[model samples]
Target: MQYVPFTPYRRVLTLPRVRPSMALMFFARLPMTMTGVTLTLYVVSNLGHGYGAAGIVGAASTLGMALGAPLLGRSIDRYGLRPVVGVCGVTSTAFWIAVPHLSYAVLVVCALPAGFLSVPAGSLARQILAALVPAEQRRAAYSLDTILVEASFMIGPAAGIAAITSLSATVTLSGIGAIFGVTALLIFLLNPPIRNEDELAPIGSVRPPLRSWLSGRLLATLLVAAGTLFCLVGTEVATLAALRANGDVGWTGLVIVVMCAASMAGGIVHGAVKRSLPQGVLMLLLAVLVLPVGLADQPWWLLMLVLIPTNLLCAPTLAATTETVSTMAPPAVRGEAMGLQDASTRLGLALGSPVVGFAIDHSSPAWGFFAAGAGGLVLAAFGLLWTRRRRPAAVAPALAAAVRARR
Candidate 1:
């Protein structure tokens, strides 16, 4: 139960600076879910356009994220997280204000760059937590940060939906821009943990993780997990339609609430337990746990109950994978690794949407859940194979004897 030094709790919560910085993250992400959802709605609902146009607009932002992350991660590694975060925050704010005016063509182009520029607050927050808090306590710090993120995302969409309905999406969008602009600036001015000079090596060096990332086994393992994440998120979106059709009017929001609440609890526990399980074993365990949600049915109570187990597997596995990736990545190219992690996540969501949407369209909601669950099993199987492959080869008896004799 020993906590790392500099952690808020390790310092007995006496560190106002640490507490405030963490609090800022809550505000930092509050608009994250809202911006894209509301922006898309605003385009279609207010501007009188089809879903295609909205989709294009949304895709533009993802493009930005795909392009921007590595550069920013590199910058954070080189200069510092604060300055990079601040720049991204300001850029995001400016882009938000102008997003509405751009035509569909212009919007798509803008979105790619913007997505790239958008400060990956989640990743940046982790970096700061690592720097400010002692290494051992960092797991707790990340757990707490994940909790804040879970809460923020849960609240953000509802708020965005409400704002668009009450005040108009355009106004809401503008307000969000201002709120974040100030938030990013304030975090910058406060000089959060990202400013710590001693931690420069992780953020600064530009070396590559050639050996680890290129290793066949490790890359395969990451991609498999990435696919599972994609399916899970896509299933969430598809489930809303299923609920409405099933006459469970209120279940849509409830499902999300259940998943996130369960994930938050899971993250807390994962942080508490000091299990030293290898990454591959942990992956398969989590994968198997989520594989049954595909069969959920009518008992309202049963829906909630099943979600607890599935949701529990979500955060910790992802966090574990991320921690593993960081460990394997070299300093020079750590940013690339972080960016790839994010891009992989985004890719999952992106790929999952079409497949889930099609399943729901062609068959039923059950199909979407089925795909998700089965996809998880596929990942689990891949993990098993990957682990096997990663194991060292058997040594030849005569050659082994010669090598040992030399030793």
Candidate 2:
């Protein structure tokens, strides 16, 4: 809870290019943030499908995005951002435009491919932040990015739901497609400095092996990133379960917003803190907060109060994951690194509902909370141990490379 002045954040904003790009990215990411919720609603409401069918479609999309992220990142690293943006933009927009008319079977089958092209807006924004700022300024940048992201979550799903409520899911889904198109156009015009050839190896220089990028440190970070989301989303599912059990479904949305506000507050503090806690420490704190939430399910208010502390750790964990990936990845393959991070997040979220839902279904709503906490702790323990054991051996190659480079 140590506070640093906002001086760092002010300086970061003062940068000529950072502000506009961030603003655009903030809007650009909205469509992406809204998709999961909006799509689920569409399938369940508009298409006359059961929750189970909607779940499958949603899961398909998540799987596609997870599979696409790394490939897209590598393409961005190799071929640059514009081409990749163009391809995804065209394919995605076309899919959405035609999708509303398709049969349910066709829609289900297309979900995976459509998601594969879902604008990589989130990853690209992180790439911009990493490339634009120096190491010292990056924590604040990451914090700011996390805050904006929280804001997007706050707005995106609500916007989608509202659109569907007022108009139609078809119109909303199609409109989101247009948003993706606009985002692509913006990225193409802005041509942000994600892949400055000068920053990377010379054109003819040999690329480092993928093994270098997938070092023990990076792998651990990826796992922790996924685990963090696992807890967050699991808690979300658990909250829903608790509400359903109590017949308080109407409170679900407001309760989730309260949780998001807690996370936003934590992000604000995390950014303002002079030296943030290590990621491992943050994960442990998160686990501690969630562990007792199960006991608080008696009353809806109690569940909200219990979730506050656990949710507070949410954005900080995500921001730290971004910062770690930024620091760990070489400039040459930073896009790929960010992509992998995005993929890990998607994978964790895809797993969260099922894992928590099963726990709640088979046992009790209380077990969902317990399972979330236990899962987080188990993952954190794995990462911490793996990192400690490999610490010496992991740095050897980099050290040798540094020595060679200095010669």
Candidate of highest TM-score: 2
For 1-407, candidate 1 gives per-residue lDDT tens digits of: 88543344455235446677788878888878788778778788877888878877776677667667667777876666677877788888988888667675666677777788886776666666655666555565666776777899799999999988899655788888887788888777776665345534553545554674545455755675566576567557546655766787577678788889988887777666656454455555655654565467455456667767767756666666666666566544556667766776676667667667777788877677766655656655775676567655423555789999999
Clashing pairs in 2: none
Clashes of 1: 15
What TM-score does structure 1 among the candidates reach? 0.84
Each prediction's whole-model lDDT (CA): 0.69, 0.86
lDDT of 2 by residue, 1-407 (tens): 65448877888899868999899899988888888788788878778998999899889888999999999998998898899989998988888777678878998899999888777988999999877877788888888898898889989999988997898767988998898898888888888888544576775877667996788878888888888888888988888999999998898888988988998889878887788998888988997789788888968888898889888888888889999998888888888899999998887788778988999999999999988888877777888888898899958887999999999
